[model samples]
Target chain A: MELYLIIILVLMILGSIYSLNASDLLSAVISYGIVGFGLVIAFLLLQAPDLAIVQVVVEVATLIIMIAAIKNTQSKIPKMEFKPKIAIYYAITLIAALVFILIFDRATGCLSQFGADTMRMAQPYIDGAQHTKSANLVTGVVFDYRAYDTLGEATVLFTAVIGVLTILRIKGKKEK
Target chain B: MIIYILCFILFLVGLYGVVSKRNLIKIIIGIAIMEYSINLFFIMIGYIEGGTAPIITKGFEHSKFVDPLPQAMILTSIVIGLATTALLLAVAIRLYQKYGTFDINKIKDLKG
Candidate 1:
């Protein structure tokens, strides 16, 4: 299982790198899809089928939205000229990323090991899920224990849809 | 674990794309990639060895289940990601309509 997870992680990393470096927007988007699928597999391997389902659906929708946006525009990225200053910027970013990673590693070193049954906060929810009469523990947590947060999430999605409509709608009056 | 480190590297790659890329759509894709990496990391944190899915069935007796809190949280995050991606695409399309090009450098009318 660990080996499978490692392989999936490597594939995801490769997909991200390819998407970032692709010369055309379409190829980049395709590679991004690869990364998304890799993530779905990883979620399954981690025993989070609920997340896998949601992620797969969301990824498909995101890809469709992106493709629609790109269909009417230029899809090719203009070639970039390499500059000495750009190299310096890359070096700086690399050093900063390394330092950030080291700090994160050190900070999380005291946490419980992977797949260890040491999550105290979740124990209550797991034990009480039966009383909630929900077959899926995740559903119980999302809809019962944390229903208010879900309501807020629904509100956020509604607001985003309204904002998108307002931004993309064509105005009747043209100033030109 | 190595998984966590790899996830962070994926995030950094996405950050590089967002910072260095001049195209608006590519930047959106980078943001999406970063979002995926974070979601994956959260799910990984909740994994338990020898654990089954959090769904309870009638016939099976299971003592161990993966943490469901992160799964629920990630579900909400994924939906939010979809909404944000849709909104960003709408904005990108609008930008294209106004500027006639997707290159950020050339679409600098507001530059002082």
Candidate 2:
């Protein structure tokens, strides 16, 4: 199982690198889809089927949006000259990665054991699922314990849709 | 332990793309990649070995289940990511309309 996970993770990383460095926008988007699919597998292996479903749906939506954006635009980025600025960018990236890894290592200390009840807050939900009358504990927690947060997320989606519509709205006067 | 480290490395790759790439759409893709890595990491943190899905069934004994909190949190995050990605792409489209190019280097009229 661990070997399968490592293989998936490696594939995801490779897909990410390929997408980032791809010469064409379409190929990059396709590679990104590969990365997204790998993540779905990881979620499934982690026993989070709900997350896997959500991820796959969102991944498809994101890919469609990106393909639409790229359809009419230039699909190629011109080659950039290697300069001091590019070297500085690389230096910054290295420093940032190192600092992030150090802080993360110190903060987490150790990875929580697999199949362990790591979150105290999750206990109540697990214990209360029967009383909540929901077959799915995740759904119960999302709609019952944290319904307010779900409401906020809905509002955010609403606002974003409206914003997109307004932004993409065409002017009749300009058309005339 | 190693999984988390690899996830973080993926995040750094996206960060590098955002910092080094000169194209607006590519930058947006990088941001999306960073979002994916973060979401994956969160889901991984909640995983329990030998755990089943967090669903109950009739006449079945339940032993262990994956943590629900991170799953819920990630669900919300994924939705929010979709919204933000849509907005970013809309903005990218508008920028292309106004500037007639996706290259960030050429669209520098608002320099301070």
Candidate 3:
């Protein structure tokens, strides 16, 4: 399964590169659409069904918005040519990111090795908590150990809504 | 695992697009790619080898089930991603209306 996913990832990367190089707007859009769908499948294989579903939905919405934008703004911007040797730049950045992640994952694995410890500590609490009955450990974590965080998250969303309203200035406008 | 490395590569590809692509739509796609990569990473963390789903059935035992916590976390994250994508799309649309173009390179009014 992992090997298959790796192959798919490689193919997706190649497809993205091809899309990047394709001069046609429609092909680029199609490539992005394919990538979006591929990501949804990858998310499910990685055990994130909820994310997969939501991502697919959001991606469809984004594709629609992008198509609309492209229809309105149809021409490429004529500016300094993209002659920064993108291949070299991407290769270097990819290596740097991979090294960083590897070092961090390895170093964190060495330091304290507290993942199991944290789980062990939380185990009794988790088992004892009535909230676990909700069938969502994340919700338990959210509303129990970190109820304050949940409140803050809710506040952030509320603030975002207000911000959107302020920006729209649609005081009497019908809700969409 | 190889899966993880590939996911990281996918993430790098997306990040590269985000940094190098000047088109607004491409940048948005890049961001969406990054979002999916993270979601994939989170889910991978909870995967158990040969482990069954957490659903409890009449004949099922609890010992073989994989951890359910990450699944729940992913559920919340997915919803958050939805909200983010919606907000960003709204912003992108407004940007198009304001500037009449999706070329970030041409947007010079906000430059410092």
Candidate 4:
């Protein structure tokens, strides 16, 4: 029953997104909304209600911000349209989707055993960890086993913000 | 199976939008779509068939409990997504204020 519902939901999402190709701004907006909502639903169905909540909230903010930006930047500028060969694109995409589905199914089946084994082996670590109070294995992995990587990632984000602000500040000074 | 294929298709369409669209906002939409697709993919990864909710109860045994780890991982990812989208929108707003247009073709003042 759940599988059938999932299939229907998937179809609805695909149909809505495919409709985004229409050369209409309203269609684009509606399709994007559907896509975003579908993603949140997909997350919920996949046992990640936390992600679903986050995704929905973030997506709403993103769409609103983008729409505001789009409205502000309103102009009579011509929209760029793709002129790809329709048949070729469709055929390629269909084939690619099929191949991707097949690969995912096969990989999932193969990885299931490995995942169980890994989980069993890690049982001891889970049992022994003092940080189990955090109630998050990925968090434990992030801040413990790969603290260096997390630190580097933080550094990168900090650097990016500083760089962008510096550039914008220079531009502001020049404009004044 | 079909759900997996549909997700891939959605991703491809978003990719096409990002690659082919010249409007900055459209490109941003494409990027947002891609982020969503990945988020969905990650969620799907942690699901167990016929899995019960991960709530603990006294003296109750459940053989089919969903893994809650991916949900936790994605919680972080979603916040990151929010930060990224906010930053990107700010950049877009700044770009519009400076350039007076969202067309990538027209916003080529820095092309020296």
Note each model's CA RMSD in angstroms: 1.8, 2.4, 5.2, 4.8
lDDT of 4 by residue, A82-164 (tens): 56786687788679767876776777564453113223433443443355543444455456755676676566557656654
- lDDT per residue as tens, model 2, A1-176: 76788899889889988888888989999998988899899888888888889889999999999899889877887766689887887787778789999998777766674445676768888889878888888899889989999999999999999999988888634643
Expressed as tens digits, the lDDT of each residue in A15-39 for candidate 1 is 8888888898888888999999999
**lDDT rank order:** 1, 2, 3, 4
Enumerate the candidates' DockQ scores in order. 0.84, 0.73, 0.39, 0.37
Interface RMSD of each: 1.0, 1.4, 4.5, 4.5
Best by TM-score: 1
Top candidate on DockQ is: 1
lDDT tens digits, residues B1-109, model 4?
Answer: 5555565566766776787677676677777677766766555555667664444344424344455555555665666666566667668778878777767877886
Ranking by TM-score: 1, 2, 3, 4
Clashing pairs in 3: none
Q: How accurate is candidate 4 locally (lDDT)?
A: 0.60
First chain TM-score, candidate 1: 0.93
Candidate 1 displacement at residue B82 in angstroms: 0.8
Q: For residue A63, what is the lDDT in candidate 3? A: 72
| Model 3, runs deviating above 4 Å | A18-29, A75-132, A135-176, B109-112
Clashing pairs in 4: none
Which candidate's lDDT is highest? 1
- For every model in order, the TM-score on chain A comes to 0.93, 0.87, 0.58, 0.58
Fnat by candidate, in order:
0.86, 0.73, 0.26, 0.29
Candidate 1, after superposition: displacement of residue B92 in Å? 0.6
**Every candidate's lDDT:** 0.88, 0.85, 0.63, 0.60
How far is A65's C-alpha from truth in model 2 (Å)? 0.9
